[model samples]
Target: MTKDRSVYIRHIYDCIGWIKEYVQEGKEAFLQDRKTQDAVIRNLEVIGQAVKDLGTDSLTASHPETPWPQIAATRNFLAHQYLGVDLTLIWNIVEQHLPKIEQQIIAISNDEGIDLNAPNTPELP
Candidate 1:
């Protein structure tokens, strides 16, 4: 439904905001601390859940570049196998993949006529 899509889009926007915040102030610190690592992992889980909730149609049809499966799998691994989670791999995702994902979200929002600079936008968890 339209409401569901709106929620998913908001989640995507929130994830992008979190990524930006982490990159801006926490990137170096996150790379050095376990607590920061865990926090970022949690944020990734939130993003992954949002992506999963969007489903394949929303991801592939509406936002083709969003990597929904990988996001969902990451969420699963973090939630169901936390002990086996790899910080290095997570760090790599943050450093390499997040920027592209953010760009894609921004592009999708623009295409859909959503304003990225709007007031009172929700912050990412």
Candidate 2:
């Protein structure tokens, strides 16, 4: 069955949270740990998938500042080019892109009246 838009919104929030949790030890720690790198990469892919699922047209129009297309593209890159993943690019994304995304997702959620912390799906680690 198809999901509600809020479900995808929550997924984006949760994935960002998971990425933040994985990188809590900071940049050097992240760069040194393959498992953390892998976790962040996987969460980014999930964020992309959730963004794609949320449907680009309306969401992009609503929040034009958000880079919906690039986020989805990142997901595609991660899925297809997993073997050649660039740690620097991923690190930059975590350090930079995600906060903006997290903010925009919050904006989208508030504007759309979706409670991210609501009891819908189980939270992922």
Candidate 3:
């Protein structure tokens, strides 16, 4: 269970790094490229899965700043709603939102004294 605790944090870091890498071409390029869009969506799904795995109690006790419900819901939206997927909002999430969460993850990892950058299954951001 102790190791499981880090799963969500690592997952968040992984998603942030992956999203950053996927959107290197900027939002305009991201919006135009279907493969990039798919990659981003899949990463979001992984992030949401991590959030869901973290659960409410763990999030509140450890990293309460994360909007766990919204993260999980967004994952559901991306995974389930294909036709209604909004590229613009996703762009906003990646460009405007990811950095903030990335910082938050870094802060929490620092406070916990965990080396998130240490090599793991997906490798940390």
Candidate 4:
């Protein structure tokens, strides 16, 4: 069964938070640290997948300005083009786009009355 849309939003929000934390040292550090690059890329992948799982209808209607398709495309490129992935593009995305994306996600969560910061634990069977 599909999970709630809020769950995906939370995942995206959390991933962005993690990415920000990982790159706190800035561009030069990020470029030099392979571990940080992997971590950020992994979070980016998660963000893209979460966006894909969240689907397009509500996202487009609620936030038409958000680049949902491009987000998903980035995930696809990261997942498939591992060898050819460009650090510069990833850095640019983090530096240039993530802040806006983060704000948009916070707005979406607020509009839906979902607390993105809340604990998201699964129920036991």
Cα RMSD (angstroms) for every candidate in the order listed: 3.9, 2.9, 3.6, 1.4
Error of 3 at 38 (Å): 0.4
Candidate 3 backbone collisions, by pair: none
Clashing pairs in 4: none
Q: Tell me model 1's lDDT, rounded to 2 decimals.
A: 0.72
User: Please, what is the whole-model Cα lDDT of each candidate in the order they appear?
Assistant: 0.72, 0.91, 0.80, 0.90
Best by TM-score: 4
Q: Candidate 2, residues 21-114: lDDT per residue as tens digits?
A: 9999999999999999999999999999888888887778999998798898889999998788989999999999999999999999999899
**Could you tell me every candidate's TM-score relative to the true structure?**
0.76, 0.93, 0.84, 0.94
The reply for model 4, stretches above 4 Å from the true place, is 122-125
What TM-score would candidate 3 get against the native?
0.84
Task: Give a tens-digit lDDT track for model 3, residues 53-83.
Answer: 7675666577777676787788888988888
The better candidate by lDDT, 2 or 3, is 2
lDDT of 4 by residue, 38-102 (tens): 99999999998888888866688779998888897788899998987899999999999999999
Error of 1 at 84 (Å): 3.0
Between prediction 3 and prediction 4, the one with superior TM-score is 4
